[model samples]
Target: MGVFTFTDEHTSSVPPVRLFKALIVDSHKLIPKLWPQAIKNIDILQGNGGPGTIKQINFVEGSQLGKMKNCVDELNEETFVYKHTMIDLKEKFEFIAYEVKFEPTPDEGSKNKMTSMYYTKGNVELKEEDIEAGKERALGMYKVAEAYLLQNPDAYA
Candidate 1:
């Protein structure tokens, strides 16, 4: 399988604890509220906000983004590190696996370094244009969430 990787970094004025709580713990409820046009809903299929949890993300109808199933693989609250894998990709292209890791920058003011990887099935061909589009969408989603948190500090507390 071919491997594709994407990385993003953002500095948040909010504290790391608050940022992690909002982005990971309450993400299912907060994301749709922040970007209704892109994410219609996030349904938790199993477990709480810990590892082994399963989630289904439903994108808004007619949106370029497609739906996918995610499973939390690792979560380190003390370090604000989170990792998840795409268990299923029914709506989009063929991918054997996908993983995202969020790491808090030490000595930085609530900054986070995020890395994402996608392992595609060997036979499946992924176009560069499609990958670029996905990256843009992901960044857009993060920006929306950041904006929401900036506006409402008490959210997800």
Candidate 2:
């Protein structure tokens, strides 16, 4: 099996706490509504949405990453950080494993950053187009959530 990793990072002006709540806590509910073209639905498959919980995101019909099942690795509201990893790809990823982390930037609510790392499995070399496609979706989700929060102002408060 070949091993490889790729990371994508982005910073947003939306405070960490607010961003964390909307992105990590409420994303399952918001995403499908915001971009029905990108994601169809998100469902919690096991547990109660805490650490060790398992969830699945059902993408739109034409999406390459058709569907993904991920295990919640961490959910730290105090630190404004959330970590989740894909434990079961089900053929969605070119890699054997993938993990994403959303952390408060600079330990302040002024900014937030989201980082995603992918671990390829076996000798399969991941194509940049496929990888970037996933990253774009992730970042697109963030922007949509950010826009929603910006418009609501009091939401996720």
Candidate 3:
């Protein structure tokens, strides 16, 4: 298998803890509500939502990807860091690993960073265009959460 890594950063006017809470702690509940047409729901399959937990994300019908199963590698509320690995992408990829960190800025805002590692099934080389859709979706999700928090200042505070 071959691995390709990509990193992206986003800054938000919202606080780190608040963004973290909305994006990581409450994503299962918030994502589907925000984008009902694309995401059906997120279900916890095993564990108590901590490390080693398994989760399934079900997408709406006719979507490019049907569903995904992931294992939670790390979830730190105080530090605002989350890591998980997708274990069910058996077609083109062996697995995909992601790490997200929300850091507090000097202005009390947030600087969020995301890293994704894609493990291909064989010697296949993955290009930017090959994963552009997933990248856009990930960024869109973050923006949605940011907007939600900005609209509701008291939320996740």
lDDT winner: 3
Model 1: ten consecutive residues of lowest lDDT = 91-100
Q: Over the stretch 1-157, how does candidate 1's per-residue lDDT look in tens digits?
A: 6676767777766667767776777889988888888889999999986889998889999975478787888777777777887776653345433333344456544776767676776555667787777678767766777777778878754
Clashing pairs in 1: none
Alpha-carbon runs more than 4 Å astray in model 1:
90-108
Q: Candidate 3: where is the Cα deviation over 4 Å?
A: none
lDDT accuracy of residue 70 in candidate 2: 80
Better of 2 and 3 by lDDT: 3
Give the per-residue lDDT digits (tens) of candidate 3, residues 30-133: 99998898889999999888999999999999987899898999999999999999897766899999999999999999899999999998878787787898
Q: Please identify which of the two predictions, 1 or 3, would achieve the higher lDDT against the true structure.
A: 3
What would the per-residue lDDT of candidate 2 be over residues 42-137, giving only the tens digit for each residue?
999998888988889998898867898888888887876677787665443443344444555564534444555666555556687867776787
What are the lDDT figures for the candidates, one per model? 0.72, 0.73, 0.90
Candidate 2 lDDT score relative to the true structure: 0.73
Cα deviation of 33, candidate 1, in Å: 1.3
Structural similarity to truth (TM-score) of each candidate: 0.81, 0.83, 0.96
